[model samples]
Target: MEFHLEHPLSHSSLHNDDADDNTLPLPLFLVEFQHMPSSHYFLTLKSSASLLSNRNFAISSITQYSRKFDDPSLTYLAVNYLDRFLSSEDMPQQQSKHWVLKLISLSCVSLSAKMRKPETSVCDLQVEGEMFDAQTIERMENVVLGALKWRMRSVTPFSFFSFFISLFDLKEEDPSLLKHSLRSQATDLTFNLQHDIKFLEYKPSVIAGAALLFNSSELCPLQFQCFSNRICQCTYVNKEELMECYKAIQERDAIGVEENEGSSETAVNVLDHQFSSCGESEKSITITAASSPKRRKTSTRRC
Candidate 1:
């Protein structure tokens, strides 16, 4: 889906469950992410225990497997499924063979594609020289779903993007167009940063905020100061913490986007970020950055 800055964002698509104008608080989200099914699911090389080397192998295999599909989102989603599944379950052989992990990677990509957008035609078992029969792939998918508790709608950094972006007074022709640009940049950074465990420390909302901040610095330098000031005024976001997260994100990308206390000179407004079941009391936190047209190579940590 193209993220148009000017495109109108529905609460359902942007928020988790058609959340109202008063979005959920960041603290609540942090707490939920900590315990929710997803909180346990991350794919850091070190987090793999003895599977460190094998984790790298899986990354390589999945990267190759991703090429078989036309949509990149399928790969990203499949990676999420793979990481989550690995978090709670073990390989059938438990590191007895390399092909086992490769099979898992294949199953993940295929299952992700099927879950996200199932095709009417039977899936092709062969990608390259390797082949996974339908039964084996289905068995793996069942294991993955069980591990994830069938929670396919994984809450991601993208979930909090709309609330954070709403804080910015980005009035333009079809704000959807601009929103898309910002969302696209943020999505790219999120995908690259997934391999690192450092990001897992922060809530997805905070990470989303940081991504928007970096995108703002890169794409909307002219309004960077204004955006920074407005975002800091948010009660839910500690200015220091958000800035710290933003710095980490930039360093990880190695793109070197600088942050300045620029101008709180811009008028700050309190946003009632009322998320689902978190109560309507939490109010007034804004975090959003405008989009940029330029693209830069992200220094992703391989392996």
Candidate 2:
């Protein structure tokens, strides 16, 4: 969709002196930004996860079977499948998480081999670190195709980024400015540095939402308000909750001293060790989702 910066005024309003005195023209940027709401973010995120899950299943299977004899172009092939899979909205949901990832990855490698080097066969994907046998990969591929009903197209995050970027009237000289801004916001989100929002798990959808929000704000103040409003309307999450999460991030980053003296590597290792203890079992997840049936599908797709 193209974003236009034109404002529409009624001829009657132009003729009426009282109307001119009482009404102010709405900003074009605000009008456009307000076209969609915040809930759109959640919806899009859910869709992305569902689509990516299939690709992951495909990739995993190919890598497992092709082990030591795996094709060199498998990675490229898998990524291609991912791109194609996410380009449309009709992707299907698979029952097993592992299956989805494996199938997508395998499809990617297969396509890559066909296009880049026709001599490459499916047997070439069997390399170490990837332990799926050829039969397993083939079975998973069949299962994925069935689950997806052969409709693999999906709209990926990259497309959303391009669409959102086009909404602003940025200058050529400041091309990198947007990237820098996005990077800064992402860093803040990841480290919990700028706000109280502490995202335990940084998913693609969350990143996309943050990127869009930050970009829109830079384009115009009204855009920020409208975008924020739209987000709220579409999502069950309230502004206050998001703000609180941002606040938690800020608080976490404001630590005065380290708990122990160690090198950076040691510090990272220690942190990882501490956080690794917080594991959740599949049964626990099932029980939790059961309590909130409305979120069951969402949790499965995302997790």
Candidate 3:
């Protein structure tokens, strides 16, 4: 496997026209993301406390259920579809049932896999425990696709890795190994932290860069500062916001450190679930919700 790590001029300009190819420019979709952010997640849930509390809990279950599937990308895409759909669509006033939400999850994951890994079979993705039939999955996917405007290629933090890595300009022997390693670490961190509502405020590119910064300190201790300095010099990135994001990642990392030092594993999960509720002024995530055709109302909380 070959990976394209070219330095793209702007994330707003790259596109992969060939269907057989899976290449995506980090910028083009990002341009759309400016107007399409997920910050409304918790606030929208606040609007209907009863609906949000119940559905958010179910959403958490769906997130866990998504683990039964093979790829993390599928979960990411499904969540993207879910968020975009809920944020924009007013739920049928009749209220939702658990099965209906499950179908939505199945459809979101199904659609996610198809978009990212086209070769993946829908039947295989259904796996054990998924109750939705092919037609049902297809129907739900249609609703989600329409809500998300068929923009299946979401602008996630992963999208910005190539461009950010290219900025470091590593000159080591087999530099590719170093770059690939850092990207892997950052990608893992991104997935782990994706459930946090706080990350919603930062642009995907900013989050991608911050993840790289966090990993570089661990993956390339000596050269990490240089990478950090280079990113800070980036005109497009906001230094203050990047540091805020970096701090949040660090706070998350601290939970691991605490566990390694003898804290209970159960305690860590509890701490993370209440992470946003911590109410630390600096760690706060605030996004005002408004009417939008494509924004999601949010259906699940990252448990």
Candidate 4:
């Protein structure tokens, strides 16, 4: 993870003196990372076929359905709901049921749409045309609400974009333009990479770092070393983990190959064995959205 910096940053460069209102301050950003799924959750996603299939279905459904709307945040936020719901100790029984999975996916998009546009109702966001009534969708929404413990606001990688961009020492005259370009490129990667299950192993912060580092190599090859060194020096970053995620993204980008899970055994005892609680309380964080090629347009809303 180490990089040779021809011109090393001074101690002051590592500290954020001015805070951007759109981005979380450093202290709050660190607190938000605590709410991400625990490492055990990733293990369960690997071990259980039912869980993996449900996740795949939910993500795919959300991706397909979310295309009609022009909001990028909806897909990511809906997937976030799906992940948190699946990660909870009390998931709905019959994980293999198609109707139940559709209900879950529908309810998630409905909820995200409501958060972004209060005028939009559950009935309006129904996917694949009226699969379930509004009342049934609302009930499932309640189930999702309970599973997430009423924590609708999510802390995603977007929350860290501005904060991380600030860490770089941009010598360009229009630093804001460079920052916007970097953020846009990184945003594209974060949205597209969500389909890959392996990324679940990394935290949003680590994912953001990897995406930024990956893009920096192309956008500013000359300053890549300096940017990497500054990011490594950040107190909140785990250098090893960042490098691991970075390499994984690089490999995926190089091959342009998307990984798909193979057929597996039944879903027996998966909920009882894998979806149990972590036996500890979790915290919370806020989120926002962005526009990109693979993403829909979105208004500001907590993910």
Candidate 5:
């Protein structure tokens, strides 16, 4: 999807007219900066256990709600908004108020649907006996827009999938089929890995490259090195960073594999050992989506 700045302005009136009228159009440079990864300040923010747990709950809530719409793009973008909002602003002591959490999830998903032009009804999303009125959701949408600086065009790993896939040299008669399958596999990996906070530390492009490389290792082991070399040689990709992300993904997938085989005890041991050896900065890494609990019911009163 091409992200022309004018497309967003044409579709949604969520940005306040007065505020927008007062400000000049965003410059190309500033717009490009939005696509970059999280800043060091956000990565180093001192988050308490409660804050991380609350964030995990909100992320899981958004994940569950978006799936109801049966749109992968919607789910991806909603979670992207949630993470970016949390990174930009600090939310302290928000765990106790479940309403605020539900509101955040709804607003993010609503905004994502608007941006993607998905056939989603806000009323239909009022799940688990919780109903938020359009006006209340609109208000929260404004909050999210302000926090995100009206930059709804999120640059996720999906953005680089095509570019990386183009680098592959498929010798088969039906390369398009191979490419589609490979892309699909990589896309699912990227989506599932988002729940792991450690993946957030890497840029979208790096994550995209790593995901592609990981998928290629399975689908085309013989050409894995070729794919890796091409990806690493790209000017936008940092070799060391990609390697770190790849390692983290491998470790996360390992735990999933162990758990699926009915070795819950071994999975716990692997998680503990990995966290114990990593530095203080890496301790924020949490469980992958494979072992995450089922999405709890959302219970917000009508707003």
Candidate 6:
């Protein structure tokens, strides 16, 4: 990757004439970048002492490398680990940004596989990234964990899935499948939108709890009641705001239904011409109460 360096180092920006000032002065390198155009400025300053040549690549690579992991929780872990490692005194000064990023990505996958699927070994991860070797990955994992002080467990996607499940009425077995589908949808949705959906923005723990409650038919009512009580206690969002979101979702669903109906009619017309002699055999689809939509009021328990 080619990097353009237009501005040379200047001493005037570095000197603090105020000798009386007790605070340590800002670095000259930072001041130089501050004067440069936004488009020209790089995130990671290329220090002659450091092994990393391209700082821009370092910042950009982190984002690109993270997508390979595909799991949000794992990506979050990698990001946190990278940030913590960079801030720590023990971080290898000689290591390139590319190496650091690669190491963190490897560590995240290793940790995730261990936690989520214990049966999967380190070799599995190596195979996924054809170019990367297992030994390099293992070494990086140790370094990352040491830098993080081994405090890895934190917010996760499963927790969020569980919380959302609690808000709806679903079976125990239903939740597992629902969680899988929701996670898959969330992955695709995030990629296309590059933003988190409002409905999926709750804390992972809350979401996991909610998912459990939603999945169990026996527990859903109680869970919803508890959620309602908690919402009343919390001042973050009022009842009006909640109702507005619900209304918006309903309108969107209605529009989708109209589109589907038009498509169905078109399909039926195409089939009619193909099988004209058997037209009478085509049964009229009657939507009964079992198939028809039923209006259910959003229940809110008083605090």
Leading candidate by lDDT: 4
**Candidate 4 stretches greater than 4 Å from native:** 1-24, 92-95, 259-303
Score candidate 3 by lDDT: 0.60
Model 2, position 73: C-alpha lDDT score: 31
- Determine which window of 10 residues in candidate 6 has minimal summed lDDT: 1-10
Rank candidates by lDDT, best first: 4, 5, 3, 1, 6, 2
lDDT of 4 by residue, 1-303 (tens): 111110011123333344343343565445554446555666676677677788888777787767777777778878877887777766742356777778888888887776655676665566555568778988989998888777666667776777678888899999888788898999888887776766776777788888998899899887877888877787777776676577667657765554432223212121122222323534111111223342222111111
* lDDT (Cα atoms) of all candidates against the true structure: 0.57, 0.37, 0.60, 0.66, 0.65, 0.38
In candidate 2, stretches whose alpha carbon ends up further than 4 angstroms from where it belongs are: 1-121, 129-136, 169-207, 214-303
Candidate 3 C-alpha lDDT tens digits along 1-303:
111222223233234332212234535444636324345654555455555544554456557656766667767656756666666653452357777777776677767666655666767655476566778778887887777777666667776776678778677898989998998888888876655544655677678878998898787777866787777777666666676567556656876643432111122122223224434453333222223453322111111
- Single out the weakest 10-residue window by summed lDDT for candidate 3: 261-270
* Residue 207 in candidate 1, Cα distance off native in Å: 1.9
lDDT of 2 by residue, 212-275 (tens): 5644545444455555555444342334333333222322334422421111111111122212
Tens digit per residue, CA lDDT, model 6, 121-222: 666454344456777777777876776566554333332332243333335566557545544554333222111122222232322333333333233444
Q: What's the TM-score of every candidate structure?
A: 0.64, 0.34, 0.67, 0.74, 0.71, 0.35
Candidate 1: tens digits of C-alpha lDDT, residues 45-163: 32444454555567677778776566666666666666666656454314436787887787777666665556622265346666677788788777767777775655566666766
| lDDT pick, better of 5 and 6 | 5
lDDT of 5: 0.65
Q: Candidate 2 deviates by what RMSD?
A: 16.0
Separately for all candidates shown, the number of backbone clashes (residues 3 or more apart, or on different chains) is 27, 64, 11, 4, 0, 16
lDDT of 2: 0.37
Q: Least lDDT summed over 10 consecutive residues: which range in candidate 4?
A: 1-10
lDDT of candidate model 4 versus the reference: 0.66
In candidate 1, how many clashes are counted?
Answer: 27
In candidate 4, how many Å is residue 179 off?
A: 1.9
Q: In model 6, which runs have C-alpha deviations exceeding 4 angstroms? A: 1-96, 127-135, 164-303
lDDT of 5 by residue, 1-303 (tens): 423222333334544343332132333223434754356422332245555666667877897777777877777788888877766654444443667888988899988887775556787777777788899999988988988888788767776676678778778789889888888998888878776665666677778888987788788777877788777777666676676576556666865743432111112233332222334452334332232242111111111
